[model samples]
Target: MASLLSLSTVVSHRILSLHPPPLNRSLLFVKPKLPFSRTVSRDLRMRLHSQTTNYGDKEHKPSSIDSKLNPLEGAGTKNLEKVVATILILAQVWSPLPLFGLDSAYISPAEAVLYSPDTKVPRSGELALRRAIPANPNMKTIQACHSTRLFTFWIPQRKPYGTMESNVKKALKVAIDDKDSILASIPADLRDKGSELYASLVDGKGGLQALIESIRYQDPDKVSIRLASSLDTVAEMELLQASGLSFLLPQQYLNYPRLAGRGTVEITIEKADGSTFQAESGGDQRKSATIQVVIDGYSAPLTAGNFAKLVTSGAYDGAKLNTVNQAVITEDGSGKVESVSVPLEVMPSGQFEPLYRTPLSVQDGELPVLPLSVYGAVAMAHSENSEEYSSPYQFFFYLYDKRNSGLGGLSFDEGQFSVFGYTTAGRDILGQIKTGDIIKSAKLIEGQDRLILPAQNNSSST
Candidate 1:
């Protein structure tokens, strides 16, 4: 009966140990895997002992029991203290949690496990874990964890103005040596981005004004300016040989009377391949021909005599048409025609001459001998106004367009130019002429101070 009672007691104790009372509701279900020992109640301890005896026939080894009990034995003091210290340190660093006053005695086994720093065991993962915690909870920790990111945002942003100003001054100096260098110094990226701004600051009108102002204020005398001048002298001479003038003959007359004898002349053409040909008497044309006025005895003898002198001297050879107005006779002369002033021929002083019965009449097949009446006829050219007359080696042609007549009777009344003859043939050639053409005097009758008129063949000759 005594052995059976001991066996029943042992079985009851084993059953009680195997089926211990439920854990406290406030305790954590999954405790932290902290490096700490565990502590069992007295009731749990006795039940464990009985279960050990009933589990196997052999006695439980003391070393095994000691090994099993060692963890619980030390959990209450040294191991628990280390765990609590680790948790406190971690809380202080990670958050703003108060660690000054706390009852560690009331801390449960599960709560004690929470204080362990198992999550931060690895060195690299500690920083990351700390960062995950709220920064407001632990300002110092967050700052330490994200020092690089915080510093980057906290720095001030700017390029020193002093440095920029110095660069500008240096660039300006370099520009003095080489104007383009100033543009080169500008950063390429900025220039490309702010091209208009650069242009305004550099070479635009405002920039120029600024530069000028700078020069005036900084180096007054060094500023530069340029000055300039021009001169022209126009002297025109006109020469005329009326039956009344002799010693007054132009130097051209004295030199080449033969030229002065002729009525009109051509000088130069102002066209390519002869488009609008010009003559001494006429302005411009597409084609042209030459005309030679000869002093014949049948014409006014005294006039012919005076003309023959100019022709023989070659004065009128290259003379130009001085003036030409429509319905007004064209005037030609030697020398710069403007230089020679001819006095007007006044009417005969006293008209008490004897009267003759026979009237001057024209013969058969003859044209009446009348004073020159042709208007704008080919003649010599002269300048505006003057006295000393010497022909220029140039000429112009007069177009008989009859626009100027009522001003004065078409005669040598102006004393500026003289009309000797007209262009009879090759009028059509005038249309094919341009500015310049050579004017040569036709050879006169040998030993005769007159031109040999062509036969009345009626054929036009060039």
Candidate 2:
């Protein structure tokens, strides 16, 4: 039988002979010492001169033979042959016929150095190696290595659990079996890293210890905790703003003319609750009351105009203060009106200019603006709608105190209702009156059509 090297050379020669030679070449020659050299030369010469030769023409046959024997012919064929020859030479140098114990189960020194991970050993060699080693002593060495190192290796020929997936599963099982030991074995410097990996494994298995272990990853300096706290605060503020609670940020105060030239009436709220507590005439007694507000446009034109339009022909009269919580700006019309209410005429909040001339500032103490300032100011109420411009008729008062300089000095027009007349006096009186207080008769004061109060007793008291 031909040696493996010779057989390889014969195969190489057959592949080279299929291609044609380039122009201006007569013959091809390859060095003999090289494994594929002689066969390559023969093949290349055959391809180069075959085109010029005719078997029936004896004269041309000699030229063909002479061309095939020469080394300078068939440039293209020669170059191709040289490439094949080089590959064959490399194959011979890299893989030689085995001498003794050639089919060892362990990787050969040469192969270990030169072989890529993708290279596969022949099955025949694997069988030979298995037969040579009785009872496979190498298995003990493999098991020992597996015990010491975190990794495991397997020969491809070994049946049953030789696949990558199987090996990985095995490793995982081993790791989990000795989880605590593995964690303890890790160096101190790498404990955190090891802990994270361990936690991940434990998490998959549903363990409280794993969850608790994750906390160790948090910064011990409290920086991460502070950052988380800040984020929570910001998220809460964003939620408030989204919920229409941001309008309470501005001060809310309502100023309207007292009935019949009695001077302007001012009501202030210091909380989000629509109800405000009043101190008794000369005592510390407190009471809560709801104020009915009308927007007239006679005294404070801007304030009255803005307030009147919101109430009557405009859009604010009956709008709801959709964002009132207890004790904060009970009601206020300072924010975008359309957002809170819908009116006969759609009016924009921008139309209501601030009337800063009156004694409306908190500095004046007429209306104290406070943190929960939605208590008792006039505002349009509306139903919740996707478009935000659907509030009408549902109005509340902001009891919270706020600056009202911008809304205090506004004048009212003839046809509008008083924009923000105070109901505190009425509320106070009503509060003091028991639920059974009977009204004998009601009448307007002599000539003042706007002055209306509880009728005084003309009868003598016993």
Measured against the true structure, the TM-scores of the candidates, in listed sequence, are 0.23, 0.18
Cα RMSD, model 2: 41.1
Task: Report the Cα lDDT for candidate 1.
Answer: 0.27
Candidate 1 per-residue lDDT over residues 310-378, each given as its tens digit: 444465444322111222111233232322221111111011111111111111111112112232233
- Per-model C-alpha lDDT, please? 0.27, 0.27
Residues 139-192, candidate 2: write the lDDT tens digits. 222222222221222223332223323433443454456556655644566567
lDDT of 2 at 18: 28
Clashes of 2: 89
